[model samples]
Target: MFFSKLSYTLGLCCLAAGTILQNGQVRTTNYPDIKIDVASYRFRTYDANATEISYKGRWDSKKVSWWSAPGLVFGFTGDTVAITFGDLTTDTTLVGYRIGGMDWSFTNVSAGATHLFVSSATPGVHETWPFNPLPFELRVTNWAYGVQIAQVHVAEGESLVRIPPHQRTIEFIGDSLSAGMYTSFEGLSSFAYGVGAGLGDTEYYVTAYPGICVSDQNCWGNPRGQAHQWFYTSDTSWRASTIWGDAPEPWDFERQETTPDIVVINLGTNDNNSANNVSTATYVDAYTKLIQGIHGKYPKAQVIVMQLWMGFYASGNSYAQNQGYEQELKDIVAYFNSDEYLSAPLVWDGATNTTTKLDAPSEPFVSYFSTRGIMQHNDIGPAWHPTDVGAIKVASHLSQFIKLTFGWELVATGPEIFHETLYWNDEQNY
Candidate 1:
């Protein structure tokens, strides 16, 4: 059975008390429903390219399973704010928040133009009274389904104001690892710990496809293509590069918000899956194309091709004969870091193993680069994906890399970082 979850206290407040006399007469103000452009909010760690914006005046996110749109925070001032969206299938599960900080879930809701309202009062009771305009923020916990956000609204008489988006943004593109698959949900999934929590100020966008490859067919009998999930709305037969063409309705990227300053790619694990029979040269060529494509879209962005987390091949296969996937990733990084620039390229030679230190420094970035060091397989999740702790470990490594490479230092001793490290280290056997 499906259930809704709330992470904050639900204090009982009387609706009649919303407006009380203080100095003079009663004042009642109603604001118009504020239409927020979904493109205005930063996707944060999501693949901004894969997003389908302006699709019939909606923001439709087509991502893989387990992907969450976490950093979409917007502020509206009203007695009641309603989130309106279009289309909902059995696959869609939308979890959102209200002013009092309670989570309300909408599952298998409805299709085509539906509005879910969050009021200052409890559900099933409607008592309209006078109240001042208060700013409230709401966010979507997950987007496993293809749900299109049409607009955010307040009452017709109420006003809905817009909050500015975050400043620094990063996009993560890869397979299940980047998708936070099997990562703990509410401390149950393996990597449930907050790896991305430390970057609370920064917006993140994640575009990861489980069991997907950059160029070869997925080992799991899924789609077969390049990392087109980076540009398309959903993981379907549609090509992200061509979805705009031959469309009665098309998504315009020019209207989309947030061009990433940094892009992290963790692929090839599925490409190297034994069933694919892909060669190193072919893999490198596909990987190069993926980077080129991303750079082509955002020329000023920095790219980091991550090493595969597992040394094993697909479905009980080992990388013993294929010279190991770690070496292959290192080789790709070497090619990208070659003497293209006059200065000696900062190359990650796959030196460190799974765990990485916070202060670790990679080679200086010339162009887009690759990461070394194979992620640990011992601490994998039930589906053989990165555990919650493993995800944090990987995030920690990336956190370190981003800090050193971009000179963006993170708060190492903060509670988020400390507790994440402590809990993961104390529990993760891998």
Candidate 2:
């Protein structure tokens, strides 16, 4: 099993440069002038503990489970780079990858097969400069199952290309939309990806689950406890205490040694569904408490209560019935940003002059912004989620909001709200 101790002959793989070939899609922007070279045929292995690899998100040793958990970041000069994962929970799941932080392309995690996270075989990668190792990230694209990364295989005699540090860490909390629902593409075309890529130096962390809510009751099929996103770590986190009769500790945000600088909450749409509906006061109260909890954990973090109104869901029954409640949610955000919260310390110890994460919390800046687009009936993908056009609009707006709010660098403008392509790529989705 010690692959680093063994040696083997290598082969020549198909070579490529980063320049766009047939389609107009960009590959590697850094390497414009391109040429092809024969890549190493064989592989050298690195264990999970390798120093060349940098990790983000909540990891337990070599394993990580959570919605779109930021897995591994590294660089390598290999035509065929693959990863081997040992099943942590016996169920097969998906893992993803991208080079230079483009959209993630994914591969299935079979029991023992070597999954090529990135390779020359891929379309865009087929044209990237192969002389030096290109930066790559490995990610968990789902919460259905956890994964234990056992080994990373790259071209012969190659170690990982070291990943650079990010300017700040941002955590996104929400359900379906933020969870990057993957009926076909496993979180490849998520708005979160566009945000991170647009933000330039952001360390992305997401804790989204499908059907999670802001109230105590389950949203039809959800299993997390009351105010689950704040009170617990995951959907089944309450199982130990309620079902197995064990006093399990909730998720420890301090365990990570730091909290996110910015936290975006994209919930509230699921508050009122066919099965359960909470009162406006109940939803607002729960949401306020969730904000307090986040402040307690990360006081200086700028919180964005994103009310995504784009796509078909906005004009549907939920919007008609829950518009008032959504307004209430928006009002709570205004209250946080007002002078009232500054006077009320019990609600949030925000006005304190503190620089570090300590008992005396720092004042957090909060804002609410809704998407600026009419519901394109045609652009909505399966399950009423936004297609790439809609998501890009959200990403463009949200990224600019974050950039301006934090006084960070400027972000490039992406597609407009009314983008050209309203057609859903049905062939790629289920």
Best by lDDT: 2
lDDT string for model 1 (22-72, tens) is 123443422223334434432222122313211211234431122343323
- Which ranges of candidate 2 are over 4 A from the true structure? 1-44, 77-80, 89-92, 101-104, 116-133, 143-146, 182-186, 230-252, 255-258, 308-324, 344-364, 372-375, 410-430
Q: Roughly what TM-score does model 1 have, to 2 decimal places? A: 0.61
State in Å the error of residue 425, model 1.
16
Per TM-score, the best of the predicted structures is 2
- Write model 2 residue lDDT over 220-290, tens digit each, in one string: 45544235444444344322234223333356666652468888887766675534556667778767767
Candidate 2: RMSD over Cα atoms? 11.8
**Ten residues in a row with the worst lDDT in model 1?**
1-10
User: RMSD for each model, in Å, please?
Assistant: 14.7, 11.8
Q: Candidate 1's error at 430, in angstroms?
A: 26
Q: Please state the error at residue 169 of candidate 2 in Å.
A: 2.2
